[model samples]
Target chain A: MPYISTKTNIVITKEKETTIKEKLGKAIELIPGKSEHWLMLSFEDNASMYFQGKSDSGIAFVEVKLFGSASSSAYDKLTAAITDILKEELELAPDKVYVKYEEVSNWGYNGNNF
Target chain B: MPYISTKTNIVITKEKETTIKEKLGKAIELIPGKSEHWLMLSFEDNASMYFQGKSDSGIAFVEVKLFGSASSSAYDKLTAAITDILKEELELAPDKVYVKYEEVSNWGYNGNNF
Candidate 1:
């Protein structure tokens, strides 16, 4: 399973949220074995966030967590794609967006470890 | 640096939010080199979440991200502390809460990697 959560300073409208979700669904496919079927998503819009000690401009922090590992090249492509999606949908500059990936060794669900 | 983000299905009031933050501030100290000073926290209450394909009761997902590694025993302590905090503040059962940890090798801030 893979989970992608986005926190952004800019407000996300329902339409924008849907578009971003769709784009991210496609972006996650860059990984070899991950797909949107098992991808969980979350978005926090108009979040109280600061970058470089400033919050006057739009910024986005996206966290991608997967159950297993992926290649560096795969991560590189996914990052580029995520940045482009934020830039296109939220008007956030490429530099203002930060995407971090975590390969989770242990995940829990349904009151038990997975 | 360490960041703790919590997502739950229950609505978090202002008072509850403050209380949880304070409790988590103390909880982070369970890790040897970590403290509240460098802790950045985010809470997503009333989020659309599901467990075992159901959403009838309260559920929480907590994510802890650190710049470096920590021992498993340290994680165990933090998990218990976090679970207690959620249980006391949000009234969520321990079994319904999932805490995941990520140790990042590359972290970015202020337009550069750390």
Candidate 2:
């Protein structure tokens, strides 16, 4: 399973949310064996966040968690795609966005480990 | 640095948000060398989350990211404490909450990698 969550200081209109979701759905394919069918997404708009000890500018933190690991090259590609998606949809500067990936060894769903 | 983010389907009030942030600040101490001074927290309430193909119940997904590594036992303790906090504050069942940890090797801050 692959999950992507975005937290931004800028307000995300419902329309922008749908567009970002769709873009991320396609972006997840950058990693082999990952697709939107099993993708879980969350968007937190107007989030209280700071960068460089300030929160005046627009900022977005996108987290991508996968059940297994991917190559560094794959991660690089995904990061570029994610940055582009946020920049295009939210107008966030590429430098103002942070993308993090975690390969989870233990994930629980429905009262059990996955 | 340590970052703890909580995403749930329940609506978190301003009062409850303060309480959860306080509790999480204390909970981060379960990992040695981590404290609230360098902690960053984000709460995504009323999130569209589903578990086991259902979204009818109160479900929480908590993610803890550390700049470095921590022991598995430390993670276990932190998980228990987080579950307790969410259950006590939000009345979510422990089984319905998932706490995941990630040890990050590269973290960015202030337009630079940390």
Candidate 3:
């Protein structure tokens, strides 16, 4: 299972959120052993986030968690894809985006650990 | 900085949410290199979550990310504290809760990478 969550200071419309979900669904394909079918994406707009001690600026915090391991190269691609997608869709700067990855040893679903 | 984000299917009231956040802020102190001062917590109640091919059940997805490394023992303590707090505050079971941790080398804030 793979879950991608993004929290941004910029507000997003419903249509844009859908577009972003779709784009992230496709972008995640770059990483092996991940698919949109089992993908979960969460977007939070107008978050209480600060940059350089200020909150007026737009920033994005992206968290990516997967069941298995991925190469740094894969993370690089994923970050680029997500940054590009957010920039194009929400005008968020790549420099202002932070993407963190976690390779979880255990994940639970359907009442059982996976 | 340390960020804790939780997604659960159960509905949480504002008072309980505040309690949970405050509890988590204290619980995170168990881990070295983390403090409540720079802690960020987000809670999403009534989330669309599925377990064992079902969505009606109560389940929690907790994601924790920090700037530096933390020991597995530290994680174990964090898990127990979080589970206990969540169970007490939201009445969520420990078995249905999933906690994932990430040690990020790169984090950005205030228009600069940290």
Best by DockQ: 2
Q: Write the per-residue lDDT of candidate 2 for residues B1-114, one digit (tens) a residue.
A: 999989898899999999989999998998999999989999988986654434578978888889989876788788888888888898999867877777899998889988
Q: Who is ahead in DockQ, 2 or 3?
A: 2
Question: DockQ, per-model, please?
Answer: 0.16, 0.20, 0.12
i-RMSD of model 1 (Å, 1 decimal): 4.8
Worst 10-residue lDDT window for candidate 2 chain A reads: A105-114
Best-first order by TM-score = 1, 2, 3
Question: Can you tell me which runs of candidate 3 are displaced by over 4 Å?
Answer: B1-5, B13-43, B46-60, B63-114
| Model 3 lDDT per residue over A1-114, tens place | 787878888898877877887888888888997777667666678889998888877899998889888999999999999999999999988889999997886454433345
Q: TM-scores of all models? A: 0.62, 0.61, 0.60
Supply the DockQ value of model 1. 0.16
- Which candidate would rank higher by DockQ, 1 or 2? 2
Q: List the residue pairs that clash in candidate 1.
A: none
Distance (Å) between predicted and true CA of B42, model 1?
A: 7.7
Candidate 2 Cα outliers beyond 4 Å, as residue runs? B1-6, B12-44, B48-59, B64-114
Candidate 1 chain B minimal-lDDT segment of 10 residues: B47-56
Runs off by more than 4 Å, candidate 1: B1-5, B9-43, B48-60, B64-99, B103-114
